[model samples]
Target chain A: MNVAANEKEVKIDTAYPYRTLSYFVEDPPTGNRVDRFLEAFAVVLQYTDYKSLLDSYCTTNNKCNRCAVSCPVYQVTGNPRDIPCYRTNLLLEVYKRYFSIGGWFKSRLSSGIELTEELIDEMAEVFYRCTACRKCSMECPMGVDHGLVTRLGRYILSLIGISSKALKVSVREQLEGETHNTSKVPKVALLNTLDFLSEELNDMFGVKLDFPVDKSNREYVFFCAVSDYLMEPDTLMGNAIVLYAAGDWDKWTIGTQNYDGINYGLFYSDWHLERIIQQLVQEVTRLKGRNILIGECGHASRSAHDFVPMFGGKEAYPVVSFIEYTLNCLQNGKIKLNPDIVTERVTYHDPCNMARSGWIVEQPRTILKSFVRDFVDMEPKGRANYCCGGGGGLVSIDEIHDFRMEIAGKIKAEQIAATGAEIVIAPCANCKKQLKELVEYYDLPCKVMGLHDLILTAIEIPNGKSAVERKEEAEMFAM
Target chain B: MDAWIEFAKGPLFAVSFLIMILGLGRHLFLQLDGLVRRKGRRLLKAPWRKIFTDSLSWVIPVRHIVDVHRTVLFSVSSYIFHIGVIVVPLFLADHIILWERLLGFHLPKIGTLLADVLTVITIACLLTLLGCRLFVERQRGVSRVSDYVLLVAVLIPFLSGFLASQPQLNPISWRAMFLIHLLSAELLFVLIPFTKLAHIVLFFFDRISQVHWQLRPGAGDMVSETLYGKEAKV
Candidate 1:
């Protein structure tokens, strides 16, 4: 409402702080008109409203900027806009302007803010810049979860069809595509991958290993970021080897439907988040599995484990992370791991989705310390650890490779370097991808892989021949 | 001046106190309302004991010293300011007498010397915070006009109350300072629920929400059917 006759009229709703977020919107929003931005935000707000929480946060945010110290992106970029508090306020201010009583009164009195195309575009860029790590939430005296607000902002923007292409495309596929997985891996391909992995493990360990699929009435149905089959064969094999070694043959099996644990909706859309979790639940239900076992992916484990009872309703299966299951197995003497295999100095990178809330923090550390002889903790390890910079699904976006490397992932690169470790083990599939990129980009002398990737190397499986024995047998047998 | 001071301390004080109570009560209600999920069963397995103890850590004035070893001087000062501002007004002899008259009960009074020391400490902390908002480049960049205005709004009552208590310390007329102190505090009371000052009540809720992120199972299930598309639920 620029109803001003002269330029001298004070526009109270003038985009004071957020007007500066005039960056490029990666995925274009649906509506062309600027006013449509507000309508979309309103629709999303009503659809997934946390009014009391948003109202308090919007009312109480003092712009302390303390969160900047904890923000990996803000620390490297040194920009006010990158600050978690500022990023969160991008939505909070909108909440105030459009939803709150005081802002309504003030807006009615004066020229209030118009949700502009530029503002929506600004949000499109700002929200993605955050890894949604939730580290900043630790330092906030007001207890505002800046990452949660960023998620809310992203959800609103996605409603207007402005989310990152990487996240949107994958989520769209997972929702509507025949494969029902983010990576679009068909059941046949997944089974083939399992068969290939079984042969590889058999050759490596001189032991017969089977990657069980679609097996019914198992004690646990496993799900990991499905892309693991494409890139993380060792991790998948490690999971199979560990579960097979730790329990009886029928203890765990991978289901065909909803086998992929990567829930991109957790980053940008509540609608997707719920439905994706439902897929995982349906898979477990279909298998008649008693428990859900989420593999090395952080958000996959968290979203599945935390929300299963909610989405599953009367049939809430007990959900466990791979780390927790392995830790339990190790403690119970269910499996043995050789610590001597890892002599190189190693450090654990706490994935934000897993460790930020202390859900899967200690279990991984316990598992790592068990087999990792030279394990060293990062300066701010565990719940306070910095993001791998490619968090919140940014790792999936190849376009922001430079932004991820130099700015967003900068702190993580340095954190890895500071550890001076040869191998940096990140448990989450998302974190593993980001850290590998960070190491390569930053020119650090560290190799990145999953926790299970190393575990597979050191695990002592029954009927598994020693490496030396297997090598000698290969020469003698002349196969 | 005598009549104005009496009016400020008696009826104005009561009305202001009522507004402050009702306003904070309403704010407290809103915050509690936000915590409730209508569509699903609230998970009883949240580590509430741990969450409560962890949240209590935020209230300790110097927890930064123990938590980060950095003592984040800004927060420590803000904490002291918060503690002092609340404690001084409640336990100061004059305020206790007013409370006694108004509510038929009073908190245990602090010695005049101790009260004076706390008031000065609170004022100094306020100044330190003000300086931080003004001088610290990062904080100043984020600071709004309302930030400075609110600091001054809080300062008026404290500065005036200290001056009003001892006539010898008062540069302005003691009666005038007394009236200003009473009026400014009342004004702050009215503004509490609307401004950043709302944090005085909402901070606990904020902490709870933070812990709530690692939610108990299906905490968000209520919105499954009722919230967006009915077909949205699989």
Candidate 2:
């Protein structure tokens, strides 16, 4: 069956299913080249030409075997059938068979293997073997999008009622409002987060911070990843220090409705992603905050930057990241750093989102370097840098721990090792957490700290509003 | 035979020069356009296109063609190939003379010794590339008919030029060699945009795409591959 017809039957019952847009239908016009090929081949469909033979064989990720060197999966497995380049070549052969005379007659006359269930399963395995990491994307010179091609293949698999278990469950949960996304916080967790923030800020900056939770109708609404509340207590507290130091405490309030900064639905489908964003944007609007300051999370920031602009269009809200706010405050002379607190061989691990994905790479680098004494750069710094392996929902996949470490973590470890820096400051919580595990696994000496941790060590709390002041502030808000 | 030599020296050289400049201009323009526009897929999309585009920027698309060591060696050879790709075609006196004939333009030559040195370097680079392709493990496994065809296409011109420059070989041999070289060079030129060669133009484009994606609000929307929630994009 054609790809379109096959995709309609796809079912997502897994943890992360490929959620097709049940709400909106789009006939993603097949690409320019594919359309031309179809039109040209239509004339000789029954003529037993290469057009027919090649068209039949141009199946996605089914194994025509052309990519010889750079496919990361094939690089790991040494299997031709598993590589994406091979699939590309298979399609190329179809192009060659009809257009290039030599390939045409031979392919048309040959009796090729028919598309069977076993063949489909094998193709799926080959397609799934790829992490969609984009290493091969850097290697292939044709600008062939192997990852997207694979996604298309995966989407096709979904249509055939063979969607993965993980994809289905995750999509379903997201749709049903069971989105335990990065920002989703339970009552106890929210309370604990506030308490921790209060303690950390007081202890470090001597600022008694009153971080209010679920306080509706404030001028500024701050959103943070739930993990930041639990693990990176310093970040929450650091934010409190800035707010308290800036004396904008009453103007800023945490959302009583949703604290999760992430919009994971963006990866699975477009419309569902739009809904969550609309809801968040609407909530922030209703809160009537002059500005929405997103905490140190990459993808969350990305969702705001990309989707908010798209969805909000002309009336887009001014959503700013903490880093941006910090830089702005520093630039405007709103805050000053105590140089005595800044002493370390520190190098910023530009979170893939903040640096490459968010265009906030330079600000953090400049800010970190300005505040720190010994600032060094990672070898493949910035956009060219490798992933933390634990990114994308892979960090939560504990069942596949061995695979994650072996495949993804290994590449990251090597990249980190090449950096030869002392401390790798990861601004995002996910990167920080993943790097923490990988550092321990590889026995690396580098310490992974949140971006605010360094800031916390530096910026001094205003007089009379020290740690005690911060603690008093927290108590007042919590009460 | 002399007429063909004269024409090759004059007309063919000029035409080839024009094609190179035009190709280079188009290539560079496309590269800049790709950077500013930043219209490329993400890791979850078609990765090969990204791979292909990125690979071209470094002037080497397929790194797996050689072992890590061999890759370094091949890159070094590629630098030599680049020098030859430029000098032997654009700066040779014969080429200049040909251009002068075709377009009435006279490009200065760097001298005979430099030309001879460049030819030798170019030949050595080609030989090195060929050696790496044949001997490298990953390259050997993936090598196809097209790969061999590209190699021959390069070698024919270099060999013809070397023979043509020699006083011992007949002028006919030189003429025949030049024709073969012209044909091969033209084939390589025409094939560039359609084949993986376009990556040379697309790499910069991909880099810009990376820059653009990094700046978006959902930049941290990294989906974790692990089953647990810890390593995911939180």
Top candidate when judged by lDDT against the true structure:
1
**In candidate 1, which residue pairs get closer than 3 Å at backbone N, Cα or C atoms, i.e. clash?**
A13-A112, A13-A113, A310-B218, B39-B222, B40-B222
Model 1 CA deviation exceeding 4 Å by range: A1-27, A30-34, A467-479, B37-40, B43-50, B61-71, B211-234
DockQ score of each predicted structure, in the order shown:
0.46, 0.10
Q: Interface root mean square deviation for model 2, in Å?
A: 13.3
* Candidate 2 TM-score to native: 0.66
Model 1, range B79-192, lDDT digits (tens) per residue? 788878888989888889888998898689989998888889999989988888888777787788889999999999999989888788799887778788889999998888
Docking class for model 2 is incorrect
Q: What would the TM-scores of all predictions be? A: 0.91, 0.66
